[model samples]
Target: MSSEFPTPGLKRKARKGGPDVPMWAARADLVKRGYEPKTVRLPYRLDEPDDAPLLSAACLRLQAEMLEWSSGHLRDPNRFDGTIRSLSRRYQTDPESPFNRRLKHTTREKDAHVLTLIEKAFGDRLVPSLKLADFWRWYDAAKKPKATGQPERVRRAWGIMKKLRELFAYGVAAELDGCARVRDILAEIRFPQPARRRVTLDLEHIEAFIPKAIEMGRISLALATAIQFDAVMRQKDVVGEWEPIPEGEALTGIVLNGRRWVNGLTWAGVVLDGVTRKATTKTGAMIAHDFSLCPHVQQVAAHVLPERRVGPLIVDEQQGRPYAGDAFQREWRKVARAAGIPDHIWNMDARAGAITEAEDAGADLDAIRATAAHTDAKTTARYSRGAVGKSRTVAELRLAHRAVKNSA
Candidate 1:
């Protein structure tokens, strides 16, 4: 409602019913008034009112400084400098100000990557005026025909496009009635194909594999597999020295050491206690529990030779070095093949098998949920649903028989 700034002589007139202008428009307005765009302090208010009040001169100065700081660190520093210089001159003010020091620290690399991919895919047509359907068509064409190989690359590209849409929406939300257009584009963007489910290994296959690994003189591999089978740990979890708990003897749940071993899990390595840090569980905050080593797991742990004060529970024999994730996968695959299991058995299957085995052993839903660190019984049910069905059917059959007998 307040029109304090007048249209510059060089600036183009606003359309009779056209949408309100953007920050870029304000720069143009300044330029028309014989002021350089770079010199203008574009008004912007911080979300935190404690920092500065909205519409205040201090807020406007702080906003300009924040923009300058962001632009200075751009990969093409000159491009950002030029943009800022144009704005500063239009506003008849310097871009650099003391307020710039208070700007929040952020990395724009991911956003930059997204922008680059969008530009490459859609060229000049990547602007907000383009329809959402057009962007989807462009995205589909950019990805290869085949589903094989890394899907993450394709996913990342889609993510970039989504970010661009958000940027456009954020820019226009207050003034333009077209905010709905950007929202529609985001809602319509299709995600990449979901990852294929990994093959789960059954107990029979695991029983066959353990002996062969030991026979082949792969002591570490044998132990790792045994732990995977019995404890139902992910490949990452099984490879390292267990996280030390005050009550180690109680042996509750597996607590992974935060630090990765140098040679990885393949070679004997040390757990860097200095690097030990707490990580939030997917289900939110929960106490880290110590995993109890089963007899077979204990046997594997027993074979670990002490080199330093504290080290990895498993290591590579030949290199005496740690094994990386990829290397471990390759070697583990060989062991799986020799043991006569199908090639599809993957790391995740151990987790699935553990859930299945626990259900088969008559563990209740709550017990399974707690053991697996699942956020709720519903998720645990997904893993043990088959066992649950079987148990329910048996219970119903017994109840029916009891009812008939009582009537007799």
Candidate 2:
């Protein structure tokens, strides 16, 4: 019987094909030792010195596997034990997972909610076993109204469908089987009809709204409303915290400790003669507006500055911490209710008012875009609330009449 020891002959044959090239051949001694003699090819050049070590390592792995097989301990590493629940958990909690790592905090939070809903529906199902029909069934269930009976809007249904696609697409990226064609198969889904929002707030609503928020001790909300009202900042930006600088400087396109400044006034940046040197944040566009120029906004900001010395510019009064997105919404709801403001006047509509104010003040599209921190002039137009459109129509008509008179 051959000894259960190193096979010198097998090691020698590792380079027999010439100078460390990959070679795999059956050995009689290996077979006689109650093991399968198999060939393994590696992706290393024959001339490389590392190739011999890698080849020997492969041979050793095969021997170990054979020994394990004899001892009934061999296991498949690529086994399909992954299920929807497991994948969702991994995506939701595994810090190393791409879904957790790559997404923003708010985005990850939203994804977690979506994953929870998905798990409640199909958590037990294996990821690789999900078919297009199965996906459609789940999607149909998702679109059904909850106990509240509020009809799920087309936009929201579409968002859920997209997230479902993302789930399967995640599986495919992780090399799971059934997800190979998941996105392509799900592409057959029909888009939900868009619901246009027509509930716009004008200057009067804001003028009536701010005092009520202040009266209810929603100081942060009041300050946020004021900023949004005057500056046209987004709710996210208005509610977002700022990293305080003693010098009042803001650096654009710079991230400090994973945080980016979004909306706030700074007294620093390119000071020139007779020019209002403006600072920019991610939410603030390239051109800066002097908030001091707006006395009403200045008054509101001054009311909040002493208490806003640290942490977020706007904070929860009860917790003394920054308000999470939903907390802010709930707080706003109470404030609006107390103020006798209609439920349909969203906090965001203040931005539309600000944009309209900019238009009413005869500021051009470029000025409004900068003031609103908008990336596109067309987007500024959308929020301009017919102000710019009305002006444009009048100007066009007057020009046409002048041309006709001159020609006559």
Candidate 3:
């Protein structure tokens, strides 16, 4: 362990013939005790403002696991058997469980976080003795205003309750005792729903974002932004998604970073009519767009040599493969910051911006609905957040009608 660093309990090993800098890893005791990860290599030195928090988080997580292990919560079969913590493990590991087989990798990662919160909340509370009030109590506690003067995290608490409901359903299916009662109780209660998002990404943002992404050599990100804006597509449809590989199966798609990546828009999807046609991942409804009409998509497409247009439309030039997962958004945000886009707007907001722009341009709701492959116009209505622009469009149309009548 090094005394030079502020973070203690990390072991160091000198490189054989590599850099003079030593490789830092978790302490030997944590390794000996068999942490679930078994590997906690720190690539970051505590140099930047962000690095300190990252290192501190690893330390806190390691310490928490160690505390749980020593307190008999993890080690004692008699005290910990059939607890929420144990059930969560089964939910994660069972081959037939939705967590293992059915969930998207991104979803699994998110649920795993919620499950950790659930484990801490319930502790040794046996599923057989659980009550609905327990959940409500957790919800109430979760919604309390923070000491930092922050408002109650109602949305966050709502999400936790939603995941808890799913866990209860799993419990009932698995025949964990008392979950049926709590599940019934949950059915009687209504959870809160947050209002639709109002923030939007517009053309000015697109003009700024694309050129910066291109300058930074993140052409894939640039193209994805353009496609997402022009085509009104989800990031998943544009950049593809990562999924867990089945135990025994061969996939034709790119398999990197230990997951199978599939379903991104391929250059093959770009047809001779200059229209890019592909089925969306979520709704499975096909969307087609003429890239020739979108200058941003057209300009970025020129950067990719015609000879290199054979595979996934968006490839990470740095890795020489498609982005692993969520890395696209991470890199997109970096470009956004450098390009002077506001933090209030997100990469996901690109779709909303496009749709709002369409509404202002007087495009029909049904037409905009097809942009997202949405089944209903009313649903698309919620995402069209530009009231001022839409109002102006309406005003212009009314005055134009009056002028035409006068001329006639």
Best by TM-score: 3
lDDT by residue for model 2 over 177-205, one digit each (tens)? 66666667877766564465555667677
- In order, candidate lDDTs are 0.50, 0.61, 0.75
How badly does each model clash, as a count of residue pairs?
Answer: 29, 0, 0
For candidate 1, the TM-score is: 0.51
- lDDT order of candidates, best first? 3, 2, 1
lDDT of 2: 0.61
Whose lDDT is greatest here?
A: 3
Clashes of 1: 29
RMSD of 2: 14.7
Of candidates 3 and 1, the better by TM-score: 3
Off by over 4 Å in 3: 1-82, 86-102, 128-133, 143-152, 173-175, 388-408
Candidate 1 lDDT over 252-336, as tens digits, reads 4333343224211322222222121122223233323233435555555555555532445566666564564367778878888
- Residue-wise lDDT of candidate 3 within 217-254, one digit each (tens)? 99899999998898888988989888778778876578
Candidates 2 and 3: which is better by lDDT? Answer: 3
